[model samples]
Target: MGQLSRLAGTVRPGGRTARVRAAVLEATQDELVEHGFHGLTMDQVAARAGVGKTTVYRRWGSRAGLVVDLMNELANQSMPHADTGGIEGDLRANALSVLGALTDGRLGATFQAVVAAATCDEQAAEALRAFHLRRLEEWVGVVDLAVKRGELPEGTHAAEMIRAISAPLYYRLVVTREPVTPAVAERSVVRTLAAARAGAFVEPVE
Candidate 1:
């Protein structure tokens, strides 16, 4: 991991830094949702976080930098994947957990804001991509276990299967503007699992 520089004397120890960081992230989320990427300003974050503008600027170099930090924080706080001792149960749990998060008004809105910003900002795009890659790796681990247990075919590409399961939920969020309900998640898991079981996701022989 790269060394992260602290805001020299700006963030006090003993949870002060954590508290302030949380406040700043919450304020950033609010600003992104309300004013969008272009309108995100240090002044707005400072006002919302109840901190000095210099404090915000000193800690995060720019609005994009602040957003990158906020994205990292959100990804870190996401729920851990389920391990139910079975492939189907684990997948169902995983899907529902993600669906629940997507349905959360705050998280959902925040995600949309970031997605919008990523479209126009290279730094935001890199951060978003990194976040997705981390999520993909987590989901793939569960599928790998399933393949080892013969629940899925040997050589099944876990990452591809996981993406197949999640793509629809994201589509609903970004395109259809529809709610990503538990039912939707359940169906996605069921369909993807069915396809995997049918060898649709198995790696082709050379």
Candidate 2:
């Protein structure tokens, strides 16, 4: 992994540095939504951001770098894990949040572009995997709280529980080519919660 990709999440920005990053990311997202990943170009992002091409190249290194940083920004902007004092409520919150992101015109388009790129590009695949993993890791805490509260099995895999809550929705959105709506999101929450409560997500002893 490149240094920028490894440190994308930890690097803090401020003042002029923050402004440049914000501009570049905005431009990157716009290009992605408008033209898809294959159409995206570092020069175009630079032009859109009103920054020099050399600066963009020197800073971002490549289109994949821009994408990783943009995804990092989105993950940072996503709301923190919900704590509704109950497992069902927390899972519902997670589902609704996923629905909102998938339904948002701009954000949804950007994700679709990245998904498409991932089909043929290894770097894009890595970027997508890392982005979704971050999201999963963030929300898995809710499941941890659920387990602690005895709403789930003591050994439930929190990450898989989190993944379960969103997998059906994404399948509908990206696989079955169906609408990803509030109804779909709610269904995912219910089904996953049932399976989770049944110990389906419990880790098997080795």
> Which number leads on TM-score?
2
Give one digit per residue, the lDDT tens place, for model 2 in 1-206.
01121123433656777777878888898999899998999999999999999999999999988988788777767777888999999899888888888877887788888888889888888888988888888888888888999999999999998888778877876788888888888888889999999999999999
C-alpha TM-scores of all predictions: 0.88, 0.91
Name the 10 consecutive residues with the lowest summed lDDT in model 2: 1-10
Tens digits of per-residue lDDT for model 1 on 1-206? 11111222234467776777877877887887778888899998999899888888999989989888877866665666778988899888777766766676666776787888899999999888887787777678889999888899999999898888878898999889987887888899899999999999999999
Q: Which clashing pairs does model 1 show? A: none
**Alpha-carbon RMSD, each predicted model:** 5.2, 4.9
In order of listing, the candidates' clash counts read 0, 0
State, as a TM-score between 0 and 1, how close model 1 is to the true structure: 0.88
The global Cα lDDT (0 to 1) of model 1 is 0.79
Q: List the residue pairs that clash in candidate 2.
A: none
Error of 2 at 151 (Å): 1.0
On lDDT, the leading prediction is 2
For residue 67, model 1's alpha carbon misses the true position, in angstroms, by 1.5
